[model samples]
Target: MKTQSVAIVLHDLRGGGAEKMMVRLANALAEQNTAVTMVLLTEGGVNKAELSSAVKLVELGSPRTLSSVPRLAAYLREAQPDRILSALTHVNVAAALACAMTGMLRRLVVSERNTYSLDKKVNTGAVMKFTYWLAPRIYRRLPNPVIAVSGGVARDLVETESLRPKDIVVAPNPVLTAKVLTMMDEPASHPWLQDPATRVVVAVGRLSHQKGFDTLIRAFAQVADIPNLRLVIFGEGELREELSALVSQLQLTERVDLPGYAANPLAEMKAADLFVLSSRFEGSPNVLVEAMATGVPVLATNCPSGPDEILDQGRLAPLVPVDNVNAMAQALRQCMEQPSDNAELKNRADRYRDALSAQAYSAVLNGSVTVWGR
Candidate 1:
């Protein structure tokens, strides 16, 4: 059988959850002997050299201006891959429009990484809201399927817009269990990890507003009296100043550490006493699963589209309401007081193992299963 070719389209090779997932999927697909290429819309950013060597990387350079759509379309037509899977909304829209014009892509898959309705709350400005409102209509006209990262995301797509259920599919993010397990076995090297007397509580994600790190800081402040507890948030973003100010204002400078982004966060998670997700909203949080894969107890916001489902209704990890600092604090205390069985948590995370998800995605891309309808 001839292997199908897949091209993953993204804005840039940024070190975010969605971008990481795209790289993982591309590599996983390529490992199956399929031709996989990552197509970047922009010329430069952080690149995913972590991807398997078998996968190719292609940058289309900067689009120059909004007027360069024709050039982008021509480039896709020239590449002529069997399938094109796009990661973010702008990239999805661009891929759809480009492929629509060229009619060269046999299958187009758009991965929606956040709750669809949250766009209204996040976009804020009337113009941005209007653009988001028009997304479902534009998405409907595009000649491809939409892949929602979670069931919450799929439901939001149907309820927030006039999108047909037939056009959307739920494909949760997969955890690279083997990589996580391997990293967990390695000795801790981070400065925070070396302190045997300190109890580490960790959160991993982009340091953005949506991550609700502000709320996490406030929650940590309430528990500052907890003996030797240190909060370490791993990831870089634009909100560093704001978060740092909040930490100082709350007199938690000693308790809270914003260590930018760790290339291998699982090692930190393994060394930590607790893992937390303080997002205001999410599509599917990859770190939550990564933490669980490390057999560390997790406490996450019961935000839309990810945590509840990933935690299996709190059986795998404690889920608290979004932005409830008090609840978050209480959950953290409970986790520390009576930690869940690590073996059980690792067992539950098996569902999100990389190989299992790769096989599921391969089945869909290979036409063995109808991915959109379900």
Candidate 2:
């Protein structure tokens, strides 16, 4: 077969779940001998270094998604890629409009990375709210396949966005990769990892309200009686000071560590005994799959869209309600006391290996399979 050209449209190379997944997918597709190009709306971002050398990077020069539409249309007219995959709502809307403006026939696949209706609770800015409100109208009119990271997210699209059920495809995020597995063995310099007597519980994500770090801190304080136990949260966001204040007020400052962001978090997760994801809601949590891939016992809040599906209906790991301090504390206590089967956790994580996801997406791009209706 002739080499197929693929382009991934993204807002930027930010340190978010969607950006990270797009980079991994671009790399994976390039490795498969598929010509991969990343069309970024903005300039340099934190994960810009993570892009594979084989993949081409196209910077649109526009600082905003809406402003980038003309640039995107120009690129589509010039490159005429075999397929285009866009991530998140704002960029997806831009991609759809760009394609309409350019009249390109390339297969366009837009992905939803979060439950937008739920995300409004954390970020209800006028622009974001209006964008999401207008998304369904644009998405419904566009003749493109939509990829939802989880079943819950797909349902949200249909129920909230009024999208057709047959138009959305449920594709979990690709997380487990050779690089990630190798990174797990890399040495971590954290004291909690170095101290053999220290029992560590780790959570990785932005330090924002959506991540529910405040709830995690309260839950950790409730379990302060568990000696030698430590809570470490990785990632940076707007709520760092608020979370820090809560930790200090609870008098658990010494026991909890908020080390901001780590470029290689898998190594730290591998060293920890337990992993927790306290998100208010998620599309498909990459951290959940990453923690499980490291053979670490995971305790995720049974948030909409990802945890229940990723955890095999709570068989792979313990699940708690979102923002429930008491439930999280109870689950944390029981999990700390038990021995989790590493092999089983690894098996669960295997379902989300990058190779499988890349192959599925490639098939979608190739139009060999219909990726709709659940």
Candidate lDDT values, in order: 0.77, 0.85
Task: Kindly report which residue pairs in candidate 1 clash with one another.
Answer: 235-260
Query: On residues 96-196, what C-alpha lDDT tens digit does candidate 1 reach at each position?
Result: 66777887545776778888788557777664666566667777865555778787888888888768887776765666745657887776656877799
Worst 10 residues of 2 by lDDT: 365-374
Error in Å for residue 177 of model 2: 1.6
Residue-level error in angstroms, candidate 2, position 124: 2.9
- lDDT per residue, candidate 2, 1-374, as tens digits? 34389889999998778898999889988888899999998777888998999999999879798889999999899999988899988898888888888776346878889986786555578877878877788777766567888888888889887899877777657798788889999877688977989999999988887889999999989898998999999888889899989989999889999998786899899899899999998888889889888888889999987889888789877899999999999999999998467789898788788887888777666655555223
TM-score of 1: 0.91
**Displacement of the residue 186 alpha carbon in candidate 2, Å:** 1.2
Kindly report which residue pairs in candidate 2 clash with one another. none
Best by TM-score: 2
lDDT of 1: 0.77
- What are the C-alpha RMSDs, in order, of all predicted structures? 2.6, 1.8
